[model samples]
Target: MTEAAQKQQSEESEKRERSPGGKFMLVLLTGFLLAIPLFASWLLIYDRQSQSEQAEQSIVTGWGGQQVFSGPKIVLPYKAKVQGSVEQDGKTVTRTEIVMQNLYLSPEAMTFDSDIKTEVKSRSIYEVVIYNSNVTGLATFKLPDDFARSGIDPATIDFARAEIRFGLSDARGLAANNMLSVDGQPLVLQPGRGLGETGNRGFFAWLDATDLADGTITVKYDVKFRGTESLTMVPSAGQTNWSVTSQWPHPSFTGGFLPKNEVTEAGFTAKYAITNLALGSALTSTQASQQVYPQSNNRPYTSFDSSGEPSSVTINLIQPVDLYDQVSRATKYGFLFIGFTFVAFLLFDLIGGVRISSVQYILVGVALILFFVLLLAFAEIIGFALAYITASLATIGLITAYAASVLSTWRRASMIGGLLASLYAVIYILLSLEAYSLLIGSLLIFAALAGVMFVTRRLDWTRTLQKRPSS
Candidate 1:
């Protein structure tokens, strides 16, 4: 070619490079447009999760109610079934009966009310579990006061805290004798029975009485029982109606439903009776009336702080699910997806040439980001599997369409689209397998990157990133 022709060719190449700006703009626009779903996903799904947590904390901190002390005292009416087996001269003789009525009342309540109205009857060794913690220091039982008025000496009941477990053991020494094994495991008669010690946080209980005999004792303990209390979420109605069944950590409400009318402040009402006397015997229930004040505080949900201060405070019910760990899990999955997409993009670029443009790359990145956003959103609303499908399908469609348009060839576009479809499907599978997402995602990402790296090891980078003149 002549010098003039060569110079003309260089000028044309410069002009083509300048015109690629429009192509870049188109790619960026497409990417931003595709990111809409990702943004939406963040807003809808994760937001609710955070809110639910706040509600949970509020319930714990605002534990309110008319604290009632029901029992430093109870009456046990018995139809004497004294089954005693005395080994007289190595011979066994046993006799027993079956009938007993136990009347239990708070010492404070029994003072003025002399007549016991409620009747509780049990057969086969009925025992009621009582705890000292159930008796409030602020509330004194009226039993002593009544006895003083009646000029009768009241019986002094000294309660002791001791750990107790029950099972059968052969005739062993009472102090440090062999405990009977009921289920092959030596049942501890008492574990941590401290009369004046604090109970486990968020959990409280007391034993009704100590084990009477050590050898071959058939014992029954009250471990779980449901209690009911009325609480008010909103006070405008002048009555509170809320109930909670006492379960560890999170309790379910029976008959205590969410408020029907929409009010600024949330009013909760429910009743829960103590269940599980084995842990702590004396029971006290709390029923609060509209003490939450969610609306006035500007936090309509259950939260300790109005501003939701501990935004990062993560409380996971599942074992091994920590806040930082979950985030790391998500991050690992995301990195794998993006890294794979990058490799795939580069591979497709080599096969299809500059015709695909950097705009296509931007579109692919947007699609990858959307996968995460969609996964998070759908996982929140529906679940991880459904959300992943929705997001992956939408993103794959967007990528395939963009690829087809940019390449201007149905076959080429479809091939790239299929490749992306496969990639996203793998990513979703990784995300779903939460325990192994990191391992799978990492392996897949490395595989893709390695494949691309091996295939393009001999390629010239200067030319790859450089503008090519249209023929």
Candidate 2:
């Protein structure tokens, strides 16, 4: 080949390599490749969060788990005769036998007052919230005068063997030295709930009602217990009223019923009132009452279900700020950060006569993805805000220094640093204002698009193919 022809071929190849079209395609491909590391980093953050949850569970298990209170109820044992057919001497014979059964009764009116004090228990990087609850209440039970209408004789009712029972979901949470009283008489509490109609795990106390002609009994008790996360109470009385006060500022009131009260920064005060009519008669029927027995083989009562009636309220002690959740949210915007910064570099390459290779762009993207890893690691030691700030500063400094070498000017490199700083600030705001993040992010993107359009309004793309000397 001629020397002139070889020179022309070299110039054409050089022009194509530095063309705006070629650089744009390379940036797009680099951005796509960067997603692999970004997603891998997100998975790592998720795995760490799961580990944190496991740590919290361990802490809560050691400290009594969550608690649910079913009742401070009156239960009585009675004898009934059942007639059945049996085979005797190769012939069917009718026999009558006496069988023992339990009659469960709830109070006509009941009132509960609970004072809950919460504390945080931490293990390593995870923390669990637990509470010591002091509860006191009064319940009044009166046998209906027409009780014999249910195929049972009132005179046959064994009032002497009557017992007062209370149900607790986790008996381990019960504090020692609890007290119970029936008609101003102190009674001894036993371990297992005497009434099979109630739950199996709880305390019961015997009370003789033979001398009481009117069949009216008043009971009172004061209980102290410890639990974690949440506390729920079942309203077993015809008319139930509950007043709960807690020192925890962030209490999430959940369950079938909501508190008709207010929550404040210092604490929360919740009140609940439930009526028998709302609870439905099915809950008070003999079949439903018998279902609570430990040997009934029936589905257990849940705080929120059709059969259980769920006439209850629950309060969850929640953390005000969850750092893991915030960090995860920040990582979701990783692509935007990388793409926008790459676009800024491209603009500098196109307008400012700076030459940045595809490899340099990929290196900058990798550094941007590393920021999330740094944030996650630091967040486990420090908090979200400090970790974010530290990671952002470190990344900005590294990328800015690299930019200075590639762009050949400290002034241009400073511009890239300022742009990154502004982006980090915007992301922090978005993270803080979660409800308005979409609106703010959309407006910021629109403004960026407008700025880019204005800056390149007079540029001619045809001139991009013109040959220029290598820098």
Candidate 3:
């Protein structure tokens, strides 16, 4: 072949590789490959979240887990006779047998006042919120005047076997010097709750109902306990009032009822009032209490199984912001960051007559993905905001320096650096406005598309590809 013909053929081959269609297809393939790292980053986020949860659990277990308090109640045992028929000597014989059963009673009126102080316990990069609480309460109990009208003889009641029970979800959380009194007399508290199925894990004190000739009693108690995250109470009384104050600022008031009075910030004070009508007549009868109390067991009272409406106010000691959660949310936008950056590089290559190879595109994407890894690592040591600033500055600086060599001009590289900085800023905004992230992201993508279309409007793809190489 002639020398001129050989040169022309080589030029044609180079134009084919750099054609708009070929470049577009290569960009798509690169995007597909970028998914691998994106998925890997998500897996890392999931692992980190799991580790954080495990750390929280370990801390809580050591500090007597989340607590739920129920009842400063009275339980009375009684003997009853039931007539039944049984086969005897091949014939049915009728006999009366005595059975022992306990009657559960809630206070006619009850009040609880709690003062809680919170602290942070940390292991490695994880921190858990735990608390110490001093609780004081008073409860009044009275037998209904017509108690004998409930088809039971008052004479058969075992007033001597009466007991006062208090339910604590985790008995391990009870402080050593707990004080409980009835009628100004200090009572010896025992381990078992003694309220039969009406109580969970807790301590009970023996009481002599016979001493109260008027069939009325008043009791008071002081409790010091330690727990993690939250404390819950059951309003199993005719009228229940709870006043809870805590040094923890973020309190999640959850349950069947919300606090009527609440002041939140730096610390919180929440008061709840529950009427007996709202609690139903469950506390009046053992059979009813069994059904009513356990029904609330599935509600978000604590980690333990007990029954009531979300009737308790829970003051949760929560972090003002979750750095791990923020990092995870930012990582979800990894693909958009990689895609927009590559598109910008491609635009510079096509419109500015610069050359950026597929290998260079891959390298740039790898660097973008590395930003998240750096963020995760640094966030564990420091926090999200500082880690984000550090990782972004490092990645942008690295990529800008690399681009200067690839594009052969500081001006062009500086533009890329500015673009990257703008992108990082947009991501931070999206992270901050979680509620509006989708709207902002959609607008950004639309604006980016409009800019790309406007810049390429006058260019002829075929002619650009066939143009002589620029020196």
lDDT of 2 by residue, 391-443 (tens): 99999999999999998889989999999999999999999898999999999
> Candidate 3 lDDT, tens digit per residue, 258-377?
886565667888888888777554445643232233533312111112473344556666788888789889988997888788878887778767777889999999999999999999
Give all TM-scores, in the order shown. Answer: 0.40, 0.83, 0.85
lDDT per residue (tens digit) for residues 1-471 in model 1: 999999999887654442323543444455556446445544544565566455443433322211121112222122323376777778897856443322221222111111001111222222111111111011122222233353222222222231222111111111232232221333344332111111111111233332211112122222211111211111101112222221122212222122222112222222322222212222111111112222122111111224433111111112112232332245345445554555555455554354555555765776677666566645545545565578778877887787666666667668777877787667557645878876886687677768767877776544424454322
Kindly report which residue stretches of model 3 are placed more than 4 angstroms away from their true locations once superposed: 1-18, 80-97, 144-153, 194-199, 211-214, 260-266, 287-310, 458-471
lDDT of each: 0.36, 0.80, 0.79
Our model 1 lands, by Cα RMSD against the true structure, at: 21.7
Given candidate 3, what's the lDDT at residue 402? 93
Q: Residue pairs in steric clash, candidate 2? A: 196-293
Candidate No. with top TM-score: 3
RMSD in Å for candidate 2, one decimal? 4.3
- Most accurate candidate by lDDT: 2
Clashes of 1: 55
